[model samples]
Target chain A: MDVLSLPFIQHAILAGILASVACGIIGSLVVVNRSVFLAGGIAHAAYGGVGLAFFLSLPPLPCIIGFSLFMALIMAAFTVERRHRMDTFIGVLWAVGMATGIILIDLSPGYNVDLMSFLFGSILTVPVSDIKVMAAVDILIIGAMCGFYKEFLAMSYDMEFARVRGLPVRLFHFLFMALVALAVVMTIRVVGLILVMALFTIAPYLTERFSASLAGMMVTSTIANIVFVFTGLWISYRYNLTSGATIILVAALFFMIFIILSRFASCPRKP
Target chain B: MAPGGDQQTTVLPEGQSRAGEVPDVEIENCSFAFNSVPVLRDVNIRIYHGDFVAIIGPNGGGKTTLVKLMLGLLKPQKGRVRLLGSDPAKSCRRVGYMPQYSTGEKGFPITVMDVALLGRLGLTGIGCRFTREDREAALGALRLVGMEKYMNKRIGDLSGGQIQRTLLARALISNPEVLFLDEPMASIDIDGQSMLFDLLGELNKKMTILFVTHDVGLLSRYIKSIICVNETVYFHHEPKISPDMASLMMGTGEKCPVEMVAHGIPHRVLGRHERD
Candidate 1:
């Protein structure tokens, strides 16, 4: 099939929609929970998965997903379990996670893994099977987030305060971690895990500045994310720019524009 | 959920002739040290139900540490800290806790109502949905703290006193049998602190309160009993503001030689009442 053929292009376009849904939904939660950095931590940790897949001759996606989820859970647990002096531990884990990925890749005898694809991204050849997986993950994320929307929102703002009020903060923390892990795994394909953090944070952050409610922020983030991804795709296609780089550029541009608009607009009314 | 007097009746011990066991809280041989430095020594103390107990001492006197132990956030190196009749962790659901100087805690973009509603989140269900009863309970707590009107406002936008009130609501909403406030009035204006003191005095009707502060004078007007800590433990001293107590609470002659000898432990005056 020709590179520019309509069906291939249409498939890529469909993949973009799925990618936006996954990124936007997860990004909204990540932004609110202040776990954007955790995404970055997980992304670097995910390199271990890719390296492991290469070394064991396993399918890259599942291996990568398993490792990424494992890393995400470990990181999440550190935050909850190591309540005191957690920053010290998380900093160490971030370094360790990244180091593990780089070292493992180095040890994967004679296999020349394309490190650039993970660092930047190469969405041009995303498989239909991967797209289907992303769609399923998207459905799960959106459904579960909506199901526990109030609880997640309540906990994100204040865990101890919520716990005192009887909010089952620990259970919600675990549930939110599960969603984050699943979302991070799904997002790896679209922007590559390396650049996923930027998308996960930037979209919802822009939306949150203007949104009065958590639900509104999620909706605004999804719409803005679709725009961001599509605009990135179009720019990369037209100008032959890097798809991942182009998406970040588009997201950043929108963030700036939103800030400028809010500046000119009158102060937001208190709810 | 206003608990009547005798909230700690369930926590009373079965053994006979234990002098240190209070009806509300009991710490037996409690010793805590962070890195060789002792924050709290082998401390034994008790607080009875319906008693307004004030823990007054200098900075680094382990007042906060004592509160954390009572909340079960920290474990003692030597002894046990009990709340109501169970261990602090097991009885956490029955205890209301408020940390002081809440104005300094940067609130993310969350509505005040939702923040107040947090107190009811876990107790309502597995997923912690807010039922009508829960909503009513949260609203009542807010009203009690004079922050009902600001319930819909963003937490970050609140004034110092308002933020303190929000925290108070978060603590009180659960209607815990025992309430602990660590410097709850620290950041508020003097007027606000005085008002809060009055509010707390009224609150003593049903629940026992343990307020941790460096200055006992500010709290002396209402508290029924006092406990002082300067690495060691002092218990159930007479709740009167003598010149020595006034100086300790004012933190002016904070380290003066005349220290109130209580519970057979000598307290360093400066250590008992830190100025800041």
Candidate 2:
């Protein structure tokens, strides 16, 4: 059977595409808002959600998504709270969040809740319900994005200035994080919690490296995300590889190649 | 000049009487420390309606720190700052602040108009819909800065001068009672500098203005007053009115010395910072 012909392959490809849409749209905001580092911390913090879902004997997707949002809100709130002491506060919270998840998992008996799947991800196992949830997440993320495009644009470019303009910056920031929460929860299946940050940052970074405007960067990022996800999936499935790790490796390779090429390109050209 | 105070009466238009008289800024005995180190010492100043003031000091002289206090971006260890008779920290929406443009990064993708529209954020509620009037006001602010044509242009695409103008527009769009500009003319051409001064002059006719700049001599030409802040704040009442006192007012004490750098301080960066 052709790669696209198999039901699992098709499901994997669809999942990758959906994750990219959510990741790209959300990642575009992350890049502009300079929240990539925060995204990294928040994604890892979602491990507790995975453990909670398995421990509760609840449906993993909904539970994980719910837990991710909870952790994301806390991270978002703390980032603001510790704005002056960001690095230190975020670090402590990061450690605490992951530890809580691990302990909870250890406490839960008998259920071998493939916690490894969360570390590297298992997109091939994405259920129909998970796909629906991802679709809802994509819609919500995109809708919010479109609605606040102007405000988001204002906030991203210059926050203090935005406040001067009478935009509810604090509220917008909260909303932005809410959407990011949605994106993080959605991608938990594709890249797992640990490497999901890459999916959110790399596609946008690539687009930024090439594009001239925010709109250009966003469109290019979405396209790049789709391409990268599919290409990564194709290589992994063809070789019977650990799909999430393979995908991340593919992204990293692209990131390295582009960074090097751009450095040289950005260097002073011969007079 | 006001009788007891050696400063000239801050000029305002006919209808702009001090009636309903909103004091744009009032900082009294404000003190601030950074990580246990004193940055500002017993700072006190009161900026009234339509007063165009410039804040000048050395790099570590706490000029920017003073702006942060006035705008309520930072709080004082002791003392109080009142903007329009309200706490600066709490009344964030009503205050317009243009941060120093020199240290800004360009890689962040945003349009010129987009940056300007940030000023409008204070006007909307949580998820409030912006009416047509809001958009028009934003556009008008952009038009005033002569950046109407480049509304959709990416902020990074603009030159240093244009970025400054864009920031100015952003500050203006909020329709603030008082506008605080930090180093508004940095990294721009002479023309841009003059354009900014001219625009600020126009703005001052309507609202109270407080601008921060490292350049001393030029600031006095336009603003009615100057507050020289180092580790402590000192008021120079009617700076333009008493042109000769620039050096004397700047040289408050033996505390702050003039730093001889390539981009030197315009005045003696004086005053003692209170140690924590």
Query: Which of the numbered candidates is closest to the native, going by highest lDDT?
Result: 2
TM-score of chain A of 1: 0.89
Evaluated on chain B only, what is the TM-score of candidate 2? 0.79
lDDT per residue, candidate 1, B24-138, as tens digits?
A: 7878988998866788887887777788888887776788988888777778989888878787767777878886653334446567777677676557665436788878888
Instruction: Report the C-alpha displacement of residue A203, candidate 2, in angstroms.
Output: 0.7
Model 1 TM-score is: 0.83
What lDDT score goes with residue A26 in model 1? 75
lDDT of 1 by residue, A119-183 (tens): 67767767788778878888888888767877777777666545544555667776777677777
Give TM-scores for every candidate, taking all chains together and pairing residue i with residue i: 0.83, 0.84
Off by over 4 Å in 1: A1-5, A82-85, A106-115, A162-175, A259-271, B1-22, B101-107, B241-276
Clashes of 2: 14
Q: Could you tell me how far off, in angstroms, the CA of residue B234 lies in candidate 1 after the best superposition? A: 1.5
